[model samples]
Target: MWAFLHRFASPPHFYRLSGRMAPWLGWACLGTMLGGLYGGLVAAPPDYQQGESYRIIFVHVPSAWMSLFIYVVMAGASAVALVWRMKLAEVVAVASAPVGASFTFLALVTGSLWGKPMWGTYWVWDARLTSELILLFLYFGVIGLHSAIEDRRTASRAAGLFAIIGVVNIPIIHFSVEWWSTLHQGPTVTKLSAPSIHLSMLVPLLLMAVAFKLFYVTVLLMRARCEVLERERNAGWVRALIAREGSE
Candidate 1:
């Protein structure tokens, strides 16, 4: 298992493997997303309190979950790159930033849309909301820092360290509701016992969450593959691969 793991650390091997898997993952993502949307929007009964407006949860919840999930992935990849000097890990770390940022943006926007009717205000300085906003800024910081540096290695290392440091905020974001009184609803689906959500709603939410995860994987692989090619452009293997492609 360890041997196989190390083998995939090779850029060429990962590039080929990801290329083969990405298409399948892409289709799976689409199918699951469509299924989840149908279930959430059509099949699930409207909330007794929030009514039809609560349907936005299908999009808002998944986007919010992905925002945190992707950040953790980026930070973990950064840790691996820093400790092992793995080029693939570095590529993955940087490639994930934009995706994570986009999710964070979606979460924020959707949260605001939900909040307007539910909380009677579109924006607030609530703990969860503020920390989530900070998360978006952190994503921007990582991308900006990487682009500002000319040397890729230096940029990656710098961004990696920053990501590592920024991880402190994740727990804060997760626990912010408990740590402080806020209008934002607490965890409904991740509770210790059975989820508070009804089965009909839970099914769609879970499906949407799975779709988001698969979507992230599909896009991450595509982005990491492109980053690898760009970073390895001067390598003999890259030149040979380009030549082969051109000839084909």
Candidate 2:
């Protein structure tokens, strides 16, 4: 088990694995996203109350879920890097930030657009909204900090510390609707009983969530490969890997 882990932990091994995995992940993500989009926008029935406005849930909900999920992943990676001193994990954490941030921004914007039509307002200080906005800021902070430092290791450590600390916000953002009386709606898909939303709406929502996750994995692998190459430039294996990659 340790041998397997050690082999995979080597930068060259990870780089080669990512190369093989990326295309498959990318194709799967594209297929899933296209199907989910069609299902959500065309097939899913409009809400009786919110009418067409609820259609935004297809994008908003999935992105929101991804924002929190990706952060947890980043934090977990950062924790591993810190504990095990794994440069690959740190690179992954850094690579994942921007993608997750873009998703978070999409969620915020879509949520605002959806809200304006239904709630008659584009912005609010509600707990869920506020916490989510803060999440976007957290992503920005990590990215910004990384860029500001010239030293790669220093930047990684700084961003890693911040990411680990900011993870506390994820749960707060998730449970904000329940913890306090807020304008945002409570849980629909998550409950002991059956989902509050109907199966038609639920199906598309789940599909989009899965699509977003797959997309993240595809992009993360791509970016992590680049990161590994840059970091391991001096290594003999990296030079050989580059030659092999170029020939292929």
Candidate 3:
């Protein structure tokens, strides 16, 4: 098992394996997103109160979910990298920062757009909103810290520590609506009880969540492959591969 894990963790092996998996992940992402959009927009009945504006949930909710989800992934990867000194984990942690940041930004924008109709304003310093904004700045700090350093390993470790510290905010953001009196609504689809949402709406929301996760994997692999090449460029294997590709 150790041998297998060591082999799997090697940059070349991961590159090849991720290359094989990315296409499938990309296709799955495309299919699910299309289905989710169609189902949410065309099939699901409009909310009795909010009407068509609620359709933004299809995008907003999923993006919000992804923002938190990807940060958790980064935090976990960073932990592994710091503890085990695993280069692959470091790469994954760093590669995920930009993607996670983008998701966080999207969530903020969509949430603001959503707030205009529901809250009668485009912005507010609600608990969840404020915590989420902090999360975005956390992502930026990780990214900027990673880039500001010259030694890649040192940078990853530094950024990884930053990521680990920021994880305290995850639960805070998730439960903010409950912990404080926020304008944001409480849980509808994710809770201890059966989801409060109807099947038609729930299905698309779940589908969009899956699609976003797959999208992250597809992009993460692409970014990791590039990272691997950059980190390995001076190695003999990389030189040989580069020569072979050039010949072909």
Candidate number of the best lDDT: 1
Better of 1 and 2 by lDDT: 1
| Candidate 1 regions with alpha-carbon error over 4 angstroms | none
Each candidate's number of clashing pairs is: 0, 0, 0
Tens-place lDDT digits, model 2, residues 80-191: 9889898888998999999989999999999999999889899999999999999999999999999999988889899999999999999899899999999998988876
User: Model 3: residues >4 Å from true position, as ranges?
Assistant: none
Q: List model 1 lDDT by residue over 177-247, tens digit each.
A: 88899878898887687788999999999999999999999999999999988988998889999999999
As a whole number from 0 to 100, the lDDT of residue 55 in candidate 1 is 93
lDDT of 2 at 90: 93
Residue 136 of model 1 has an lDDT of: 99
Instruction: Find the 10 residues in a row with the least total lDDT in model 2.
Output: 185-194
Clashing residue pairs in candidate 2 are none
Residue 235, model 3: Cα distance from true site in angstroms:
1.1
Q: TM-score for model 2? A: 0.95
Between candidates 1 and 3, the one scoring higher on lDDT is 1
Better of 2 and 3 by TM-score: 3
